[model samples]
Target: MYKPQLNMESLERCVKSLEENENNVRDEAQKALLNICRNVLRSPNDDKTREVRLDDEVVVEKLLPAIGAMECLFDVGYVEDGERLFLPGNVSLSRLQSLSKLLSAVSESKPVTKDIEENSTAQKAFFKKISKDFHNVMHYEDPDLQKKARSVIPIAQLEIAAMTKMRHLQKSYKFSDARKTTSSTQFETELTAKDLLLVELLHWFKHEFFEWVNSPKCSRCSTECVYESVVPSTNHRCSRIELHRCEKCNIIVEFPRYSHPEPLLTLRRGRCGEWANVFTLLCRSLGYDARFIYDETDHVWTEIWSASSKKWIHLDPCENVIDKPLMYEKGWKKKLTYVIAYSKDEVQDVTWRYTQDQEAIMKRRKICTEESLIQFLRSLTDQRQNSSNYSSARKNYVIMRSLLELADMLYIPNLQNKNSNEIYEGRTSGSLAWRLARGEIVQADIEKNYIWDVSKYGKMFELRYNIVKDIYHVVHNDGTILEQKSGWQEGTNITNGGIFRKVENDWKMVYLTRSPQAQYGCIKWIFEIANSELYLETFKLRTKSEVFHGARVSWKIEAIFSDDKVIVIPVSNCNNFYTEDVRKAVKLNIIVTLSGGQGQTAWQHAQVFRQSLENIEEASMIINIQLKNH
Candidate 1:
C-alpha cells in the first residue's frame, strides 16, 4: 500500500532495470525515478515568498523561496510531467515546425548526425530511436523508399530528379556484434543513452491515445480495408475514403521492419505536393530518385527501381500504397488514373540531387552559419537599454532554446545547465534566474552526452555551450546598466521623454496615448496591449506648470483593457516635438526632443512618425503641435 520515494539512488536503479519482466512494477519504479528527478530542484529549499492562487479555494503558494546558487535538479518525466510532455503521436505539426527554427540556428558546417554513425549498441539504439521518432512524424504514403541505396545523391542526379533532399535526415549504423555490448568504452555508454531515449520516445508514440491504428474506422458492415493508403475509387470522393477495416484481411500498408501496420506507416495530412517536398529532401540527402512533378500538383516525391522487389516503387509519403493503389481520377473510373498521374512527372531534364546557383547555396549557408547566429542574437538586443528594458525580453524565450541546440551539438556541458545570463545581465558569475531559464538546454546539449573526444566531455562542448549562450545575450545587448544613482526614483520633471525625479516619492502616474501620427506598426501596440495591466496608487501631472494654464499636452495613446491610469489633465495640448521639414517651412525656433533611437538598425522608430486616419478625421478633441517664436 505504500508508494516508494523518488530519489537518485532509486531512479538510477530504475533506469538501469528498464527491461523488467512486469509492466506494473516497471511503471511504478520508473514513475518514482522520474518524479524524483523532475521535482529535485523544486524542493522546499528556497527563500522568496510568492503566492500562486490556482483558484479561489485552491492555492499553490511558495514562501521563503530560496533561489539555488549551485543546486541542480533534472526534469525527467513522471505523472505530473505529462503537462508539458510531447505525448507521442499527438504532437502538433506546428510544434514540429519548431525543428526548422531549432536547426536554423546551427552552423551548416556542424555535423547534423552526431548520433548517426556510432559503432555501438547504445549508438545503434539511439539512431534507431531517432529514426523511429522521425518515422512517426512522417506520413508518406509511398512504399518504395526502403529499397533505395543510401548516401548523398550527386548534383547531376538532383538536377535530373524530380525531388531534392534538403535538411532533417535520420540514418542508422551498427557496431560489430562482438563489440556491441562492450561496456568498457565510452561509445557503449553513448550508444546506450541515445538508444534508450529514442526507444522511449517511439514507445510513447506507439502507445499514443490517438495513434493511427486507434483512429476510428467506418462502422458500415463489420469492417473493410485497414490500410493506411490514400485509396480513392473513381466513383468515390475523398470524403468517402475514410478509415475502414476488413475482417477478411487486415489490409494495411505493412512494413517488413514493423510487426503491425498503422496509419503512420504512410499517411500524412498534406496532398501530393507537400509529400513530394519531404521525399525530395529525404532522398537528396540520401541519394535517390526523388523528383518534382511540374504539373498542377507540382508533387515532389521520390522513387526507386527495386530489381529484387521487381516493381518500381514510390515513397509517396502522402499515400501509403502498401496494399492497393492511390487513385486519382481512378476514383471516378476516369481515364486519368493514379498511375497515369504519377507518370506525368516521372522524369524530366533534372534529377533529385539538383544543385542551384552559387548564390542559393551561399545564402542557405549564410543564414545557418555561426556568424549568422551571432548576428541574429545581436539583432535582438537593444544597445541603449538599461536594466529596465523589458520590451523585447519575451523573444529571448525562443532565443534561449535555439542557442541551446547549437551548444549541445558542439559538445558543450556546463552550457547544458548554464545560468550564463550573468554575462548578459552584466553581473558577476552568479545569476539565479539565468540558471533556471535554460529553455534551450534540451537541444543545445544534443550530442555532448556521449562524444568520442575525451576532452569534449570535459571542455569542448562545455566551452561551446558557454560561448553560444553568452553570444545570444550579447546579441540582444542585455546588461544590468547600473544607474549613476543608487535606486531609480521618478519625479515630476520627466524631461521630454524621461519622467521627473520626485515622481518616485509616491508612484506618480500619467496617461500616455499612441502618438496621433505613427507611420509603421508603432501605434498598434498602444491600442493593442497598452492598458493590459494596471499600476495602482497614481499621481497626476498638470496641463501647464500651474493649473488651467493656456498650454496643454496632447497624447495619442488609448488605455483599452484593464484598470485605467488616473488622468489629471484629460484634455490638453502642449508643444509636441516638431519635424525639421515643418521647422524649415515655418521659420520658427523651439526646443524639442528630436530623435529617440533611429535608423541605426532594421527595427526601430523615431525617424518616421505618422498619424492614424481615425485621429486625423475624428477631430472631436484636437491637440496639435504649438509654435513658439522669439
Candidate 2:
C-alpha cells in the first residue's frame, strides 16, 4: 500500500491558498460558477445542465482566466471534456449543493461568521487526524518507501538507455520465441496504429521479455523448488531474498525479489512487481508515457498513455492482459480500495476507473478522509507540474495531460474493451493453488453477483432542488376591457401560451394557441446571450397598485422527461424551477395550467401577468437580468 506522505499543515495551507485567492476576477467567476452549479444541482440528471462550454467567450474570459475559480470548479467535480467542462453524474449532488452554498456566500461578499470559523477549525482538525492515521500505517514513515515510489519513473527512464546493452536478454531463447511469434492480428481491430504498436510490445514483453518466478529453480539439478525460509539479500537490487529448496536434488536456491528494473531486464524473472517495473521501463524506452499502478491490495501493473487514444490504458504484463481494469474486481472478485497511478509528471487516484462498485469501495476507504487524500494527490501532481527539471512546454504538456486524465477518471465511462480474450479468465501467470489462495481465479458466475446500481454509475444523476431563494406568488387584477390585441391570432385558441421576444428595444408578446391535444398552456421567455456572461439578478412577479378583476394563478415548476412528458416539479417557493442553460441560453418557461373567461380573472394581474396573459389588458413582468462582457 502506498501511504500518503504529506505534511498536514502544508496541505492545510495549500487548501486555504486555493480558497483565499483575492483576484478581482473571482467575483464574476463565482457568479458564473454559481449559475452553472445551480443548474447542475437543479437538474443533475439533465446532461445539458452539467456542461460548461469551454470555448464560449464567457468561460474563456471569466472562468478559465481565474485559477482559483477553476480550482474551485475542479474541487466540486467539474472536469474537462474537449471544449466543455462536465460535472460527472457520479459526483454526489448533495455534496455539490453544499459546496455551492459556500461558493454563493463567497460570491455575495458574505463574511465567514464565528460559527463558520469554528466549523472550519473542526474540519482542519479532522483532516489532521486523517493525516495522522496515514502515518500510523506500518512502513508509512519508511524513508525508502516514498523515495522508491517517486524514483520508479526516473530510474525507468535511465533504464531505457541501458536496455540496448542487455545482451543476455537478447540472446535468450524466450526472446527469440517472442520475436518469431509476435503478431498484431491477435489484438482488437479497433486499436489505433499507435495502440497496436503498444499491443505488440505488450505481447512480446509478456511472452518473452519477462518470466514469472514463484520459486527459484535448482541451478545444479533441473527440478522445481519449494519455498523454504526468508533470508536477507546482499544484492542492492532486492531488499529481501527468498530461500527455496529443490525437491529432487535437496539443494538450496536463492531467489532475490529485485526492486529495480535494471536487473529485471537481464534476469527477466520475478512476480508482478518486477514484471510491472521492467515492462513500464520498456514502454518508456519505446517513447510512450507509462505509469506504474500500485494497488493497495498487493498487485502491480503498468498503465501506458496512448497518444492516439488520448487516455491511459491499463496493461498487466504478468497476465498479458490489456485494458481489463475491472477484471480484478468483477472477474476475480477482489475487494479493492486504493489504486494510485504514478508517473514522472503526475500522481492520480485511479481507483474510480477500475471499480464497478464505488459505494463498496468508498466504504473500504478508511485510511483517510477523501478531502485529505485528494489534496495529498493534488499536491504531488502540482510538484511534478511545476518541477524545475521540466521545460516550459513540458510543464504545460504535463498540466494539460493531468486535466485530461482527471476528466477521464470523472467523466469517461469505463467500458472495457470486449475484445480482450482474458478479461474474465483471471490470473493465468501463477500456479492454480496460488491463484486460488490469492483469490485471483475467476469463479463461476462471480460477475453475475456484482450488480451495478445504474443510478450510481455512468451518466446518471440525482434529482435535486434548485438553489433559488424564493418563488413569488402570481397575483392577478381586473383591468379595462380589451379592445384589439396586437400579435393575437383571432382564429387560434390563445388561452394556453405566449412567447416573449425582444423586438425593437421593447419586449413583444405573441399569443400562441394551446395544441388541441395538450392539457395546459405555457408562457415561455428565452434570453439568449452570445459570447457573454449572463446573470439573473431578479425574477419576480411585482405587485400592481391598480384595482382590477382577479384570476386564480397557480405557479408550478415543470421538468421535461426523457419521454417528452411535462411533469410538474412539486417544490414550493420556485426552488423546484431550475433554469436551463443550453448553448449560452437562459430559458424561463412558465406553464399556466388553467386559463379563460372563468369568473376568476382580475385587473391587478397586469402587475404580474395573469393566467390568461393573452388578454390584451394584461401586463408584462419586469425581468431584471444582466448580460455583460465576461
Choose the strongest candidate by TM-score: 2
Question: Which 10 successive residues of model 2 have the least lDDT summed?
Answer: 461-470
Candidate 2 runs further than 4 Å off: 1-191, 412-423, 443-630
For each candidate, what TM-score against the reference? 0.19, 0.41
lDDT of 2: 0.51
- For model 2 the TM-score comes to 0.41
lDDT of 2 at 97: 70
Candidate 1 local lDDT, 1-630, one digit each (tens): 001223333222223323222554433433332333233334323211111111111111110011110011121111101011111121122322222222222223332222212243333332343233233322222344322212222334433222221111111223345445543354443333322322232232223311222123334432323323222234311222322334344443221112112321244222333334444444433433233332211123344423233233344343332111222211211111011112211112111112212232232221124343334324323321222544445346434533543443344224322522321111111111111121101111111121111111211111000111111100111322211112111101122321111111012211121121111211111001112122112111112111121222233322221333322122233322222222212111111122232221111122111222223222111112222222
CA lDDT scores, all candidates in order: 0.24, 0.51
Question: Can you write out model 2's per-residue Cα lDDT over 46-93, one digit (the tens) per residue?
Answer: 988987654344565565444345545555556543234566665666
| Model 2 collision count | 17
